[model samples]
Target: MTARRDELAAFLRAARERVRPEDVGLPALGRRRTPGLRRQEVAELAAVSIDWYVRLEQGRVGTPGSAVLDGIAAALLLSPAERVHLHLIARGEAPPQPHVPAPLSGSLRALLNGMPLLPAYVMDFRFDILACNAAASALFGPEFGHGRLSNTARMLFLEPEARETNLDWAAFSREMVGNLRVNQARHPDDPHLAELIAELRAASAEFAAWWDDQHVHERSRGTKRFRHATAGTLTVAYDMLAALDGSDQRLFVLTLADEPSERALRTLVTAHATALANAV
Candidate 1:
């Protein structure tokens, strides 16, 4: 038991050491000989006292409750996998798995593809793009239509072009992170989700920091502006439609709010069709 507690302590220390002050929205102080975040800084962020955190690092504290563990995990900017590991070590039990996204139905695929004018797509709980319409394909471009690039969250953070295409890049990215956090809370044991989170954390410092904020969001509806390469600026309102079929999958439909945006979307769709015809 003591050995296990010691292992936990070491893990905590290592986790803390990997997160820098600026990563969590904290201003970088004077140069320190040590790397990563200081224990006091972590305590302050986690809303725990310096003494408790010190004892935790020293392996002198007992098993922390879920709330305290979650707070610490947030402060240390632990990934989903790391958070699950922390919970297991602290609670000595396996955590419950969140509902995994089921495969897209044929009807759903047909429905999404049928919408030629509107940019429509089906996304799973994790924001993986299962299928997209011609308009969506044209609007998002090739990067989003390919295999691994089909994941919207991954593309938003990892793809450099996404930063340029998204009008309000910072706000949009932060909201996406918040939505992912909501899913992470529900499905802590999901390996793919864990892997996705790890990749995002490694790829984007902004994602790493925003995730630590522990904001939760569910997508009902939102407005977005995009600068399509061929279409110029297009503003669209998106509605997330929940399927009545008991699955967690959602069909997202984007509609142009104004005449100019509608014209832009039409132009993109026409150009896309022309390119496809030329390719064939």
Candidate 2:
């Protein structure tokens, strides 16, 4: 518990130091001794007394209420996941409205396989490919066949084939980094996710740059173009539908967006079916 309190204090100091006066629409009155906002400024922004804020940062205060923590989170310009993390570390409990990532069930896999025409699959907040259908395999190639990439961020940022497969590869790569940032905040204790992130940061220069920008985004619905070896160029619209059972899983569906793409995908699917039949 003492260690936890120390961590909470350290986190608050770092978060406060990450902000600037102009960032929060505050006037730069004088030169600061630190890199970020002062303790008094943060308290003023959070509507707390300077004395109390100082005490909290010093680990001298008890667990703060949700409303007060929320105020501090806003004052610090924390992302949603960061806010959740703050609550967890500060209170030593699951954050409010916690999202726990559950493994995909058989029924969920069945649902993915049911989408024979559209490429569909389920991924957790960690961007791990849990279950993908045949059409998804036909689209993304063997990466989906291997379940999740050893590291999805590495694939997006380091794999040359991925750049060719995703037409707007650079944009998608940055978006993936942002998505991972959000997930890392949500599941701070997930060691696998942490390892994957560390590997990505060390391996991919693009990933490191985007991560340092402090931008977070989750791409829910978008159109992407893929240049398939067999199918030529196919344009598809994708959607992510969250699981109704309150799990941290989302069904990713990709549908042909135009007549040309539909024809190409149909031809590709037929060839894939014939190959599977021959193999058996």
Candidate 3:
């Protein structure tokens, strides 16, 4: 658990650097001492004693209560995922675990199979692609390649050709990165996720820049435009369906809302099925 103390310290440092004084409505006031917020300032904002907060940050104290952690999270302006991570760490509930990416079950695959008109896929908590239907394959393209498309966030940021295919590349990229940021905050000890981050940092400059923004976004309903080479412009609505077992897996489905896009979607769906059939 000594290692965990170091990890907690590192996380706190990273989180602190992410927040500028100006971000929290504090004036820059001519550069002076620290790189980020002072410890006392953080304590004041969290409504805790400086010594107690310092002890927590220093890792001298183990597993703070949820209420105290909540106060700290609020003061730090953590997103939902980050806040959860903080609580987990405070409770000593984090440790590296084996991450065997689960394949979508037969029933789930069948569900996706039945939704031939919609582009759909399943992803685990770490953003690993579990399964994608034929339409999803066509929509995301085969460069997602075959078999356990590891790390959707990495692919979106590091794959240059794939990034270009996205219509609103910048916005799409930011959202992807932001979601990963939230995930990292929540599960700092997840080795697979850490490896994904390291890989993206090594591979993509665009990812590196956006990652520094410290943005967080929850997966909710959203519209995305795709510039398909064969189908022209396609606009689709995305919905995230959570799993029942408290797992971090979600089924994401994309459906066309308008006539032109709907027609394009149909064509793409047929093309996708044909491609899949030929492969089989």
State which candidate has the highest lDDT: 1
Tens digits of per-residue lDDT, candidate 1, 82-158, equal 87888887667655554567788989998988899999988877788878889888888755657868888988898
Q: If both were scored by lDDT, which would come out higher, candidate 1 or candidate 3?
A: 1
What is the overall TM-score of model 3 with all chains considered together?
0.62
Error of 1 at 194 (Å): 6.1
How do these models rank on TM-score, best leading? 1, 2, 3
> Per-residue lDDT of 148-192 in model 3, one digit per residue for the tens?
345577667766665777777888777878887787777655555
Which runs in model 3 stand beyond 4 Å of their true positions?
A: 1-95, 101-103, 142-150, 275-280
The digit string of per-residue lDDT tens for model 2 on 38-130 reads 998777666567999998887777877665676677778778778778888887775455345677888888888887888887887767677
- Clash counts for the predictions, in order: 1, 0, 2
Pairs clashing within candidate 2: none
Ranking by lDDT: 1, 2, 3
lDDT of 2 at 229: 86
State, as a TM-score between 0 and 1, how close model 2 is to the true structure.
0.63
